[model samples]
Target chain A: DAGITQSPRYKITETGRQVTLMCHQTWSHSYMFWYRQDLGHGLRLIYYSAAADITDKGEVSDGYVVSRSKTENFPLTLESATRSQTSVYFCASTITRYTGELFFGEGSRLTVL
Target chain B: AQTVTQSQPEMSVQEAETVTLSCTYDTSESDYYLFWYKQPPSRQMILVIRQEAYKQQNATENRFSVNFQKAAKSFSLKISDSQLGDAAMYFCACMNYGGSQGNLIFGKGTKLSVKP
Candidate 1:
């Protein structure tokens, strides 16, 4: 498909276990972002990648790690997942830096027990 | 720092009626971008409408429109003739064009419920 796609639409993991959420886009956008959607917190950016190897932290990036080895894939990893990490994760991409509406994928819901 | 605030956590309107969702933000920059995104039960983030800070005219799309008050830092969405399909979590987001790469700072969403 031409749009972004997320893997494992639903997931359940145990605390202290490692889990990775995958995001891939067909547009080859230079900017890719990972955000977590909680009940009251809305969507908080976890990590963002400017290019293939350049990544930056967002407001709530404490418990997450991200890597962008290629332009199409930006994967978020939890070194040691916690119950608080149980939320919906979304991946978005945009072609322009300061302009353009973001294209998002169907979110991945992760529940940490 | 730029922060978006949605004062209404939830709102309900009967079908065929109209409703408005209020959003306020704080920022120092004069020019930026504002957006309203919809998240449905399917959980896909959809861009409902957008407004540019420099534009004097409000942005509207079909039944969705934004009453953007730049001086007051207010951006509200008004859904006319609301329908069941409009039931979703609507988020107000802001992105500063000052050295940022389209990273949206979103407010706590306002859940819209359309009742029969």
Candidate 2:
């Protein structure tokens, strides 16, 4: 239980509603990421944070927003959820981007109707 | 742009047999790394194996091994003596160490099934 953990393992929301997926890691990793897993697209990075107060967009980041006010936590928010945004979200953390593999949380699945 | 491609969407194999999953990538960075991750039904992402581009030798871990062909821009995962637990979605990913942020480009997964 010392590794990364996600909140609301499963969620259901309506379109135009707001949803936030929470991610926290005990490792205090400098780098954290949010990725969405779809059927044909595999896993696409939504957003990433290099450190506290520093976040950047990824390949599919238009509908997602993230903030890393703390090194251990990175929460992704969908301001206006859509049907296409329904997917499994994974939170990952790593000590350094140069080496080592990322540690992922047990994913959070979201459904929008 | 960097990209990873997994041609096979699904594959089946007999228990105790061997199966290979193919992956190809396009990247401009000479020094990078490739990884194979297994996503079981539990939906946890587990690292299977990793290979560095500069290293000529492939990487292996127990029953899992990778055939990394840097020249051909191909990396394949081979699972020997497959078991029932090996049935899951396998993904191939690439990361450029020299690039910015070390963001990983992942390929579409291959769902592997082990038939008894």
State each candidate's chain A TM-score: 0.97, 0.97
Q: How much does each candidate deviate at the interface, measured as C-alpha RMSD after superposition? A: 1.4, 1.1
| TM-score of each predicted structure versus truth | 0.97, 0.98
**Weakest lDDT window of 10 consecutive positions for candidate 2 chain A:** A94-103
Off by over 4 Å in 2: none
- What is the CAPRI rating of model 1's predicted complex? medium
lDDT of 2 by residue, B11-49 (tens): 999999999999999999899999999999999999999
Residue B37's lDDT within candidate 1 is: 97
lDDT of 2 by residue, A1-113 (tens): 67999988999999999999999999989999999999999999999898999999998999888988889999999999999999999999988999748889999999999
Which residue pairs clash within candidate 2? none
